[model samples]
Target: MSTTIAPDRPARTGEAVPRATAGAVLGALMRQRLRRDRWQILIWLLCIALLAMFSASAIDQTYGDANARAQLIRLAIADPTIIVLRGLPQGTSLAAVAFFEIYTFLALLAGLMNTFLAVRHSRAEEESGRAELVGSTPAGRLLPTTATVLHAVAVNAALAVVTALGFIAAGLPAYGSFVAGAATAGAGFAFFAVGLLLAQLMNTSRGANGFAAAVVVLAYLVRGIGDAMGTPFGDGTHQRSAWPTWLSPIGWGEQFAPYTGDDWRPLLLQLGLAVLLIAAVFGLQAVRDSGAGLIPERAGRATARPALGGVFGLAWRLQWPTVLGWTIGGALGGLLAGALGTVINSSIADNPALSGIRDAIGRIGGGGSGPLTQLFISAIFSIIGVLAAACAVQTVIRLRQEEASGTAELVMSAPVTRTRWLFSYVAVGVIAVLAVLLAGAIASGLSAVAAGEGASTFGDSFAAAAAQVPVALVYLGVLTLVFVLVPSWTAPVGWAALGLGAFVGIFGGLVKLPEGVRHLSPFADAPVVVGDVDWTGGYWMLGITVVALAGAAALIRRRDFAIG
Candidate 1:
């Protein structure tokens, strides 16, 4: 009976069978992703941790007296623009002021970290054809997305732990430190979900990243505008609008108000939103085809226009949206700076602690300008300059993307010379950086006028913004050289360079680094426009930029372009 084949037995179908369960596949993918992304995770965690600690420690170092701390808090609370930029002032304690000044920015940084992390592991993998390979195996369709999101969760969890430890080590209250770290992590997780959803919606990683970044910017602006427009009729209390804080994830985390009082409730909202978004991601992935997005891509012109025949025009066409986004962000930052500038002076002067802090910052670079002016301009423009440098590096890195996507080979196969092609993109990066800087200046100038600085002071605001351009150009040059020489390492090396420069430039005085090391930042050497104009330093930086460009142009002609 056993030897004879059973009459009811069916033949095998010969279809491929899965050998692993969903959990098994997910675990494998998670491990693989962690190994690949460990460096990025480490960098983001270290940056946020360092920033939190530094800000806290600096406040403790600068304002040891209780009365001066209270005075500084009162001044900060009274400034609507400051409230808008930094989120609502927390408690009157020095720790709360530190939280008020830096929590929003920390949230912003976390959002960025999550955005890049999620996009790279999801849409980027799909775009590069790795997702399809994984799909062909025992892995279920949702496994990859699930694994990526979980990886983000793990990374953010680590960020929270490290940040809490950093704050505590910096002498902040332990409970508030923990809450602040958790809030920051919550914001990051929310953006991580947003980025994942965006990856499913936008076909290309670049578009997904840009859209996600725009959301971060929009979140900040919405929170700012809401805080600034607080109802006048809400009694005599300093209670500004609290509703707007609920409208954004960043706001939700920031309004948790660490160190002031722990408001743990708003974090529930962030968690809920993240849950909703992650649920949507699974639904969208189930319906959409691999390597495709839920949102349909628009078809382009059937034939190339006359302007598109040139390298410059093509470069602009590809990167114009990126340029526009950075310009708008820079302009908004400048507007906040100018509006705050109008009030920050009297506020600082009235507070001894603030005045001393300002004077010390002034002494860092030869004490030529009024301390208040130097403090305001340096603080504002330095941030704008760092952001501009980021935009510049991104713009330059597009060259690498083109090469990897085979677009460079096609364009080079045409009658164009490599030198011309390379220069066109380099020119675009240079022009884009300058455009963003100018836009920031003009916007700041206009805001200054609106804030009663008068039309004459508009020129001063413009100079203040323009003075930051040399540092941005230095970043652009560094990135371009990296792209041409070590194409594989462009992003990490380029961004790391910019990050280090910004770190040293911003906190060098507070951290008490050697003067020579402090001046190593290109921005540090550039004259604070609120003080004196160092034409010699400016010319030197410009010359260095030129030299970098010359080297990149020469190198690209000889090296083989990378292909996917």
Candidate 2:
């Protein structure tokens, strides 16, 4: 017991120990990161492949014959909204149609996957103190950053290979498949670099993620507008050239027109932009001190306001940034919906090529004055409703996070009861969801009017946006039930429900699923406000949400608080 132990130190002999090379240090860090992130990487790769393959598989069934394929190309080229949502279709070939149908969205998915991955491996590790632990040893200063960039590269490369093979398996030409996959991967690489640069620039991981997500949203908006600008709407006789598409990195993939133009030049542009971003990331990283951001964080107020004394107000303060982010995104999405809604009629009015799509909307809406516009708005609102649910779920889940972090104990130890504390956050979440939905409605209404639609259309847009609130509440209710019943499964179950609902709602039409099966989605059951509103369905949904929240409150009072 009296024996003294000495720290492991280098020998005092005249000889110096050889230092580990940067490669060796980086290699070890990469190995550790791979082990930690292997499953996440696999799932991301699988999702990318599956999304691509699913989109490709639907092309044949959607357009059965050469004439159908030709019509699709014509309708797509004539519609600025189509080009805005999807990329420009360069040719009338089946390959071109498939590429156009899937690439824009797939590129978006790839970009998001890369962003999350880069942030997790770079800023999140630093935030959690893991990076410092690793750096305490013989590791070099740039090892962590280098490892993260390499991990992103490797994952994106795998995504490219998988996407190419998926296209080939779907019977696309090898050359086209390779080029499209490369373009997709190139888009991801550029965003991955963006995430890395943001990580160095923002003071917190949350800030980094928010900033990066904002950039992604901005890119999508710019590309959508630019693509919309590329075409003159009406009879498609007058064409206008626009440069915003060239300015957006996300727009570069569409410009490739993989199967049609087989243009490889856009890939070079993507790579060049990525290379410059990566270079800037390193330069920025080198100058910033460890655990500090390039931009200094501002100090907070020295005193809390009276409103902050209550749990409800505190919850709002903490979740406001997230709410703001979603609000901005929803506003932008609404703008797109409004712009498209305004032009939807002219785009499909006289085109025989678009008759089938028009007819489908007619069938879905039971044939009204503007059934197609209603269908489009309903679809947009459906997706937005799901996103609102997601945002609400994140907000409510902050309760569990607070509990796990031991902050809830401190708050509850005050005069607040468990019920008040729990419902306070839930109330804030409900308010946030409502605000976001309303914001989207207002933005859509204004944008539609601005886009030259009648001012009355704003009322329709607002009604459509508001009508989806019940469905979003349904999601909130379901997730709250999960949080109360099975705390650990809250995130997975909540997100899975949203994902499954969206998949069913979107793909049900493409796959020609049974009407009964399609109606299982809350969004499907919810009435589109463009026609008569289904008050019965909305009321039932609201009732269910109220019941779930009541039950959750009761349960929170009985159960022991969870800890990490």
Candidate 3:
């Protein structure tokens, strides 16, 4: 009966289909963004919040007396270098002093966090071909960008709330704490706009991240210069910043003067800048193709250089620019160490009022019962150690990037063994470590002598730099092993480990973290050269580095190339 002939039916191809609304698409995209970044964003927020809480609590305990806080502010105002590294001294009140010692670092971390978040969702997705796939769907190109902006806004808003609560939990004034949180969010959002705009101009995620980070750093440096040159107020514990401070988003955060001024007007500058940059980013997206960059990459040479003949050579060729950048940073840290070391010593030498402040600064370098000058140099060198370790981490992470991009597969076709390939990158990391430390050592010594310090400080500078070598090497070796065992974890794990270690090591004591937890950071365990010259930690780290590298070399052969 069913076999009876039926009239042909239309294919129904012309029927309208339900299309997702822009708002629905936007929400979905935002959900995806949040899901991917929840852990990372949480970690960043926690760190920022912890910094605020710990600094407020610690400052209240250490400088409880108003006169003591007043002396600290006066010292910071007198030393331009202190002003360069810290914030504008608003007043001598406990809350104001806490703000002075901590705000610049908070702004710095926020700027970096926002820039990386911007690049990760934008250029990184395009590089993986996901952008084109999404573009072909109903979501389209621009909505994804809109979603990204909204995601960033949500994160920054959380940052503002988290930071405020952190301060208030530690007994800071509630209104001023919220004002400080708002200042942090405003500066972070402006940096986010900068990163999104740069993503449109760069050909790759790597280039975009590098340029955006450089801009953030440059803004910090410029603000420091302007603040350092400012005019001190009649109280001798406050300063009016110069014009150059107005040119930096970080500088704008300083203008908030949260505890003292409690002004909301500076927030307007941050919001206005963000609005303008985001508008420009949208305009660029409207005109440009999905996978292309506004600024085209330059052409390569017709023939390979002799240095490109080997795997190690190739790794060096790819990473030298990165190495150079970190080296310059080390030099700057060194210069400050030299220039400020003497100033720090002379100020703290016999001042009973500043003993607590002196102890606070000394704790950063894992303080020693040595000469005041040596303690100051060690503290500055600890900061330099951070730069070197960061360079090492980036070097190891580059291997993962190569594998994910399929470049490692092409290089493997040449009969190179997996272990050798891994080792080649490790060798480059070693050289980078040395280069950064050496630059720091040289700059520190020269600057110290130029600052009228004794020539003997040259030896101290070299020793301090040397003490940091094993600490950096440990990071390189441990992270290289992580790359081999779990390729996808390289970036997140590397950066997270660095941030945690630095926090625990540099500020752990200041924040009164548990002794056991503080001891776990490589930075905290670095050799102390000031007193009796302890090298026990350095020796242990060297052994650990060797073992880790050996483990990585053997295990790398078992895994196949990762898919993503």
Compare the candidates by lDDT and give the number of the best one: 3
Instruction: Give per-residue CA lDDT, model 3, range 205-226, as digits (tens).
Output: 8889888988998998899999
| Backbone clashes in model 3, listed as residue pairs | none
Native-referenced Cα lDDT, model 2? 0.72
Q: How far is candidate 2 from the true structure (C-alpha RMSD, Å)?
A: 5.1
Q: What TM-score does each of the candidates earn?
A: 0.84, 0.82, 0.90
Off by over 4 Å in 1: 1-19, 92-94, 226-241, 333-381, 415-419, 445-455, 493-520, 557-564
What is candidate 3's local distance difference test score?
0.86
Q: Write the residue-wise lDDT of candidate 2 on 1-564 in tens digits.
A: 693332254222222224544566678788987886676566667666766665666676667576776666566556665566666655556677778777777777677667767877778677766667665544535667778888888888898999988888777888999888998998989988888888888877667877886677577667877876775533342233368877777888777777766788988888898889888988876666677888888888999999998888898888899888787767876876777775776666766557666644433332234556656666566666766876887776677667755678999889999889888878877887888788788888888788887877677777777777887888888778778887755644554456546544555454344567556766666654656556666788899899998898889888887764
RMSD (Å) per prediction: 6.1, 5.1, 5.4
lDDT, candidate 1, 82-135, per-residue tens: 566566655557677677656777788788888888898889889988887777
Candidate 2 accuracy as TM-score: 0.82
Choose 1 or 2, whichever is better by TM-score: 1
lDDT of each: 0.75, 0.72, 0.86
What's the residue-level lDDT of 130 in candidate 2?
Answer: 69
Ten contiguous residues minimizing lDDT sum, candidate 1: 6-15
What's the residue-level lDDT of 465 in candidate 3? 95
